[model samples]
Target chain A: MRYAFFPGCSLETTAWDFDRSVRAVCRTLGITLEDIPDWVCCGSTPAHTSNASLAVALPVMTLQKAKHMGCPVMTACASCYSRLRTANHKVCSDPDERQRAERVTGKPYDGSVEVRHVVDVLVNDFGLDNIRARVKRSLSGVRVASYYGCLLTRPPEIVAFDNPEHPSCMDDLFKAAGAEAVEWPYRTECCGAGLSMTEPDAVNRLGHKLVSMARQAGADCIAVACPLCQLNLDLRQADAAKAYGAVLPTPVLYVTQLLGLALGLSVGELGFNALTVSADSVLQRCEMVVSAGRGGRP
Target chain B: MENRLESTGTSFLDEVQRRSGTPISACFQCHKCSTGCPIGPEMDVLSSQIMRLIHLGEEKEVLESQGIWMCASCEACSTRCPMGIDIAGVMDTLRMMAVERKVAPPDARAKHFAHSFLQSVRHHGRVYEMGMLVAYKFRSRDFFTDMDKGPKMLMKKKLAFLPIRSGAASEVKEVFKRVEEEKEQ
Candidate 1:
């Protein structure tokens, strides 16, 4: 399968590991991704909060470019996916908004190009059975908490992704990779997103709640699909523990990173060491379980 | 944390309904939005209370309160609201209106952050994280915030030293210009 990939701004810098692991995993699955030419920023929260017209126009410009690729556009960042989908939804449903967007973007957009999140592409398009077939190593003993965080599933009408309140796509993907997917309640909770800069205190508190919930559910590591979610839950985890009292440190891994481990990709290939919270302990435990000859799930 | 009410007419409600395109009248004080809001504790007013303030025409309270800015736009409230009020979209509308009217938002730094982020996008056609953070520090005049995280981020190679300039930057700038011109009209 081939797709036009829009890796948003975050993937270029802070979430570079996610971008790397996404590419590595897709390659293992025989999926080819071509970068959309001159794909600009999606105007995430900053643009949408400030100027509605600019927000729509920014993503529409990228969509117009992706149309030339003659395939569906895939985004790894949840915020970018949301922005792209929102723009398409508005331009297609409202003629007045479509006119304004065309005037601002200087391109005629019929919203024909399809936008899909990487997680959706994996579970639905590629099929979990095919993913299971490609696994070279089994993560039998590792328990993963699937963190959806918001934008991936919420505002269901626009995103139309998974279940808004309780999503299972990430968990299903992990299960297919032979890891035990733990049930967690805070999967769809807000991670204080853009407020990570403005209101650090609030974000710390929210992150603490999420980590504590994940620990309570007995997850060895938290798997995320969004860059902001991973940053807050992993990078800010220590500070959150200090703020809300001590909880066992739970490492945060991108969904693709965990899948890469099961697919026999090297740590360097998946950028595992780039994480603030170390995944070494959990990975070692998995190795022990495999060496003990209990690697296969029943 | 409020001043005297300027007007209690339907003007504020009408404006919010028109701008957000939500059915404000359908919100029957359910408080479901408030129950689902993760950042409700940090907000000066709850989500349902913000809707009530708009209905009562308390524009000053709704706009100036930190509630609008505190909204993460998670859409939890919008999804769970039985009346389908689009609470998150209304919060977005209120935030933009607050900026346009020059209201002293309870969280001024939030507004500054948005401006700094947009400036980076306007210049580079994408967000240069370091550049945007620097611009935000200059605008907010609080440089020491998150300073310690920088060294670690740089060590991890998470912080890029320079931004790769996008070739379509000029075209992106033109789009921003057209949007501004349309707003002026």
Candidate 2:
């Protein structure tokens, strides 16, 4: 499978581990992801809230470039996926918006480029059967709470991928990887995406609820698809726990990282050292960590 | 709490309906939107109340309300809405209108965060996290925000020391410029 990859900004910095695991896992699966050259920010939440036209224009500019690549645009960041898909929807359905976009960018373009998230590519294109065959290490004992968060599945008409209310793609992937996918109610809960820096209290409150519930559901760790979600749930996990008086840490792993571990990739390869809440206990539970060493490299 | 419909005779509900293109009029005040809102507790005005306020033509209340700024834009409300009104989309439109009209947003930090984020995109084509965070801190003047975690993140090599400048930065700037020009026109 070949795709024009738009890793988005968060992958470059805060969520580099997610980017690393995504690339490693895709490489193993024989999926070719060609980075869309010169892809800019998708104008995430800020643009959408500040100016509607700029939000549409930014993604349209990138989609216009991806259209020439002769492949679907793939992104791991849920925010990027939502923005791109929303832009495509508007550009195709609304003539006035399309005209304005063309007039602004000075490029005549139809929103024909298809956008897919990494999870969508894995679950649908690769097929769970094919992925199951590739799993070298079975995550039998490790219970995973697959946290979809908001962007990947919501605004159903725009995203149009997976069930918006109760998405099972990530859970399906977990089962394929031989991990026990725990049932959790907060799968599609908001992690307070952009509010992390502005109103962290809200982020903490929401994050705390997610972590507490995941624990209640018997999950050793939380798996996420969005960088912002990972950052909020993992980075601020301690603060969230402290604020809400929930018992200690819950490791947050990217869906790619979880799959990477099941694919027999080492902790070093998946960049597990970067995770704030250590995934050591979970790794040990899955028997991915034989030795009681710090770095759980196989 | 008494808000008389302005004699200025502009229908705030009509304006929102036009801009968002969502059937705001179809909302029957079921409060489903507010009920599903993840950040509803933090909101000064409930999502359903905002819709009601708009229906009542309380433009100033809806624009200046903390609820619009506090919306996580999760679309939970939009997803579960029985009337098919894009509640999240309406929130987006209201936020843009508030910014455009300089409605003295209740949350200054939210305003600064949005500005800081967009400013980073305009300059670097993509977000330079450290630069954007610093700018946001300085502007919002909340210096101690997440200060404790900075060292740990840096130590883990999670924080990029310098910006990863995008290849087509100038083209990105052009996109921003064109959008701004169109908006002005």
Best by lDDT: 2
State model 2's lDDT.
0.89
Candidate 1: residue pairs that collide: none
Please give, as one word, the docking class of candidate 2. high
**Candidate 2 residue lDDT tens string, B2-45:** 45444333567778998999988788999988888899999999
| Alpha-carbon runs more than 4 Å astray in model 1 | A288-298, B1-10
**A1-298 in candidate 1: lDDT tens per residue?**
9999999998888898899999999998999999999999999998888898998999999999999999999999999999999999999998988999999988899988999999999999999999999989888988998999899997899887688988999999989989999998999999998889888889999999999988899988899999999888888999889988898888899999899989988777788767999887677856833222212111
Candidate 1 docking DockQ: 0.80
Candidate 1 residue lDDT tens string, B90-147: 9889989998889956447878899998888889898888888898998888888778
lDDT of 2 at A274: 81
Those runs of model 2 whose alpha carbons end farther than 4 Å from true positions after fitting are A290-298, B1-9
